[model samples]
Target chain A: MDNNGFASYFRFSNVDWNNMWSATWETVWMTLVSIIVVAILGALLGLLLFETNGSSSWGARILNWVVAAFVNIFRSIPFIILIVLLLPATQAIMGTIIGPKAALPSLIISAAPFYARLVEIAFHEIDHGVIEAAQSMGATRTQIIGKVLLPESMPALVSGITVTSISLIGYTAMAGAIGAGGLGNLAYLDGFQANNNAVTLVATVIIVLIVFICQFIGDILVKRIDKR
Target chain B: MIEFKDVSKTFNAKEGQVHAVEDVNLNIPDGKIYGIVGYSGAGKSTLIRMLNGLEFPTTGSVTINGTEISGLSGKALRNQRLKIGMIFQHFNLLWSRTVIENIEFPLEIAKVPKKQRVEKAQHLAELVGLAGRENAYPSELSGGQKQRVGIARALANDPEILLSDEATSALDPQTTDEVLDLLLSINKQLNLTVVVITHEMHVIRKICDQVAVLDAGKIVEQGPVLDVFKRPQQTITKRFVNQETGSSNLDDTTVVVSELLTKYSNGVIVKLTFHGDQAKLPIVSEMLRQFPDVDLSIIEGSIHQTQEGALGSLYIQLIAEQQDNINGALEYLKTMRVEVEVIKRG
Candidate 1:
């Protein structure tokens, strides 16, 4: 602690790097699992919402109203409140509510409808003419959905997925609120509770790196699938 | 053959109901180039669209080739649609696909085998003179080429009837004529019945064997092309024909028939409408030579090439007298099928 080397007092990266590596891996795992669930469940919910419009059908009207209320309720609750409210449910589902796995249910709940609505909007934007052309060619309803309408709307869906994946990266860091061991927990506990500025600095750098990688990969996937 | 029995279409608009096509009945003969011409909002497009089962009439029956298409629903309707090919004004070829792929789309829908479809698509491409441009996307082709691709795609199924809903309306004059000529050739070579609907009389004059003038959702006038052009019954049809005939002064271009009869008081003033190679006939010269007292002065005439042949009309003064037995001789000329417009007497 000589006055001449006092600047090293705040020099955090000078510490051991193993803690940082572990925290980085936890954030990557949480983000990957969350995005996969959102992509699948969201696509299904999105398609249901589109097909079950109320104007043409009374049966669909009641179903759409119920589904719509459910989506809005989950989507309206703040992410932090959602995680706290779901502790019992998450504990029962995962057999424990404190690890990286317990956080999965709430992460999916908060993000699924958001991404699903994005998928819905992507589908609604397709040109009506393309669908008419397909029907005119004697395409069955299933064939029109599988061949023409889906392919024409692929670019918008791909772009929606890019946005959804990047947002999930942010949601994973916030998952540390539930004792999930990601960079957020490391920064919140080992740095703030231990009064160790050095540990905080390392966690901060790793989180930034994770965000950058998520964006880079998502950009490449989006560009590849974007036909238009 | 096609027939519309009391067809009517009304769209539910905010202003109440919109009657696009009224109680319209029309009979189109098989193997004839029939045309429906009308201004926008006159329902010419909506009227022709019903022929292919595209627009269902509110209260009427449409029979094509003796099959009632009005009652057909879903797959049956589409199956009927496949037998009737349609071309659009914008040439709506799929922009993402290549020229050959667009042509093969309908064939694929029909489940034609892949190998045979490829061969048929190649033959159609050559027919449209785009043999080497098969791989070109619609964005890579010109307006005319895009329309040719549309034509190839429309005829890919080898439909018995081809419906042109303002097909040439989007092309320039030269391209319009080219596409019209191609349609005429297709009609002749395949004997495919074409129903072309447009507002341009030039289209009617150029390719139609049978012409129907539509106005306000009704068939105002319809007949053989030569008869319709020569003696249009409807005011709208007359206006349309006058546009092509350049009859800017049909009222003022009085034959001066009275003056000819008084001056050459010994002669007859006659008007003849010449059509086909009949215009090239020496009938006018022979008529004068057969009656030495008669003198001929041509007033107006122009030859029009129709789907039938070279057709034209002439307004002339035949200076002759009844005393020379010219009236009986002119009666003989009528037997030759030369249309006579007797404007004055001698």
Candidate 2:
């Protein structure tokens, strides 16, 4: 189709296809970086929750309570409010709070605890028998975590990350309202404000497509890796 | 050798303190299959767990080869554990790992090189008869096969002592026998001291050289398997022996004697325990030959083989018009080393 035919069909002459593509790229970058950061920090915190709370010891119990309280406090706050609350910290860390990089700190802070809870549930689902077996074999705590717990709970963890990633996608769109330019910014400023219904619908479809692709890949990977 | 010196484990619960084990002293010798038999909640599991240092005693010491296991910690405790391998009732193989990978796990923890780890795992897999199923996940295997993987994993470190905590309890009778046989072979081939905790006396009868009967968190009776079967001192021990031999219960013996007393007023009822050489002898023929006037009617009898020897018991009614001949027959039976207990009309 010619440029005019495309413009008439979409009902918007100032679509700025390059800007929409860049915004999509921005959303992808923010989501990916936040997921990687969340995965590492979340797994460690999840393991701490698992080990400390699992057995009956006063020291571990206290530590578990502290960590659990921290996670719960962060997880209970609304993501939109959390982004605003973390604005100073994000600006200090990134030297700006209005782009893809600036969105990461808030995204990670919001998602890590959420993902940590998921990770704890994933590790909790593993059989206690497996841990006992490793202990009987004289595995150290580190070995037990790396060799036994992590491998045994990989499928659950992967599925958790997929869920977290999808949630982060939605959060990234919210980050756009705070001047963190992405697909959400395009939808709000260009489509919603410009009275372009076509742009809004197209942006919504692209976000949905991204989440769908992530879920589909996550499902396949879980199926492939889960020996159990 | 593993020795428990006044070891007792007590756990604090909301209700009260639960004494899992109480003042237990056990000596398990090297290169022997020792069975600890008890019903559920008898602290058999706790007692075995102490041997591996999984559960520490509340008030005493557990020594393996004269090394106090309770005092060990960190690397020392881990080193102690490496010498004592254990298997579980659930056959706790990691579901994510294949059979060979599971076997190689302990070796990996010990930091064995990959080549040697694979070789050792392969050897252990074949040892446990899982030679061709190295890549099979635990979920893909049968209960017996999964247990074989457990065995292989336990043996990866070449432990001197193998603790089996109701290892075959979850399997069928046929599968139980197979796993027991595998354990027996491992005990013999490696000269591994195997401490088996089980509720089934049949397991003790099959391979255990020494047996201990645990009841209410205490060892009620313990001895060589044949001796325990032949002369069970505790009521629980007697019940377990009777269960294994399918013989009349001790209380039932009294009922049978009373019934015989009403049926035959002149006859004397006697219970005879025949063990080892005595069980093989034709004591009934000899008794008849020695006292022709006395007539013997076998009421209840059973003979079974233990790891040590054959043990048998017979409840007999001795009928005779003359009481002197019955006494003479009893004397003759005792001369032949038969344990005779006069039940009625002595």
Best by TM-score: 2
Question: All models: lDDT?
Answer: 0.79, 0.89
Residue lDDT tens for model 1, B1-346: 8999999999999999999999888999888899999999999988877876668899999999888988888888889878888888877666557889889988988889999999999999999889999998787898889889888988888988988889888899999989988898989999999999998989999999999888988888889988888779989998898887776565554646555556677655566777777877887777666667756776666777776666677767665444556675677668767888776665
Chain A TM-score by candidate, in order? 0.88, 0.93
Q: What share of the true interface contacts does each candidate keep?
A: 0.21, 0.77
Q: Which stretches of candidate 2 lie over 4 Å from their true place?
A: A1-16, A54-63, B248-265
TM-score of each: 0.81, 0.92
Report the lDDT tens digits of candidate 2 across residue range B159-247. Answer: 99999999999999999999999998998899999999999998999989999999989999999998888788999998898788877
**DockQ of all models, two decimals each:** 0.27, 0.75
Off by over 4 Å in 1: A1-37, A40-55, A60-77, A85-112, A115-120, A181-228, B245-272, B282-301, B314-346
Clashes of 1: 2
